[model samples]
Target chain A: EAGVAQSPRYKIIEKRQSVAFWCNPISGHATLYWYQQILGQGPKLLIQFQNNGVVDDSQLPKDRFSAERLKGVDSTLKIQPAKLEDSAVYLCASSPTGRGALAKNIQYFGAGTRLSVL
Target chain B: SQQGEEDPQALSIQEGENATMNCSYKTSINNLQWYRQNSGRGLVHLILIRSNEREKHSGRLRVTLDTSKKSSSLLITASRAADTASYFCATDAARGSNYKLTFGKGTLLTVNP
Candidate 1:
């Protein structure tokens, strides 16, 4: 099985600029996640999608960050007017299912997009 | 809010030695998972221990979970330089679905050959 795939390994933008990242999860996966990782911090869940429907987005920084998963397959995360503080690695992860211990136990991740806001 | 904190934020040791890292969490959890990351890239799942299970081992990795103390530890025996990376402990909050993993800051381990 192929691992989760992400595009544009790196990106650089100015403050207030917009950026987007794409992710392709493993086949048959029904849950997708977007996370933000600061240089010295752990990944923080920005949004979670159970299939095409959103299961959680409580910490998405909705004013600028948004994500969507279509057809319950691929997902995209976008940050509009990104701030200097938004410079971090954006990671995408997927699980086999939203429920069940099998799915909860593991998450496959992508290489992530390293964003630099100048 | 972070669910856990890892001890010895960073460690250095020689190859063939054992490396152990500890984690402490705040809330009740259904399970605890450990993950490894290299160069701050994608994370790789290492192991998982259920709330009822006290210990588990995979390959050279050993994980112990203590629900009573709300803590867990990861031990790597006969580690190699390839084992050098950041280790994170994630907890699945009892209140939410199991996929809601709350990760700690992580412990960076350096294994020198």
Candidate 2:
């Protein structure tokens, strides 16, 4: 089985610029997630989607970050007017289950897009 | 906003030895999972232990969860150089009908061949 796929393995942008990352989850997976991993820190959940609807995005910075999963199969996370603090690896992940209780589900992750904002 | 906190931020050991990593969480969880991230790569799911499960084993990996203490530990037996990577523990917390996972900073493990 193929793993979660993300585009543009690495990216570099200037402060105040805009950047976007794409993610294509595993086949038949119903849940998709986007996370940010700053250097030396764990990946922080940015947003989560179940099917074509958002499940949670409380941690996402509404002023600068946004994400969408239009068709429920693929997702895109965007950050506008990026800041130096936004320099981190953006990881995309997926799981097999949908809503309701989370049991023993494990998430599969992509190689991630490393963004370097100068 | 991080739930899990891993111990011994960094560790170095020789091959064939045992490597143990511990994680503690702040709130209640439905399950705990471990993931491995190689340099410049995304995370890979290593194992998952439900709150009801005290221990689980897969291959050379063993995970123990103590809900009373809100702590968990991962043991890699006969570690290999290939095991060198950053290990993170994630807690699956339920919010109403939805769920979210909070990951820790991670433990950087170095194994010498």
The segments of candidate 2 whose C-alpha lies over 4 angstroms from its true place after superposition are A98-104, B94-97
Per-model TM-score versus the true fold: 0.97, 0.96
Q: Which 10 successive residues of model 1 chain B have the least lDDT summed?
A: B93-102
Docking class of 1: medium
Model 1: reference contacts kept, as a fraction: 0.68
* Residue pairs with backbone atoms closer than 3 Å in model 1 (clashes): none
A8-43 per-residue lDDT for model 2 (tens digits): 999999999999999999988888999999999999
Kindly report which residue pairs in candidate 2 clash with one another.
none
Q: Of the candidates shown, which would achieve the greatest TM-score relative to the real structure?
A: 1
Q: Please give, for residues A11-57, the per-residue lDDT of candidate 1 as tens digits.
A: 99999999999999988888889989999788999999988999899
Q: Evaluate model 1 with DockQ and give the value.
A: 0.73
Q: What would the per-residue lDDT of candidate 2 be over residues B1-113, giving only the tens digit for each residue?
A: 89999998999999999999999998888889999999999999898898999999999999999999999999999999999999999998744525578999999999999
TM-score of 1: 0.97
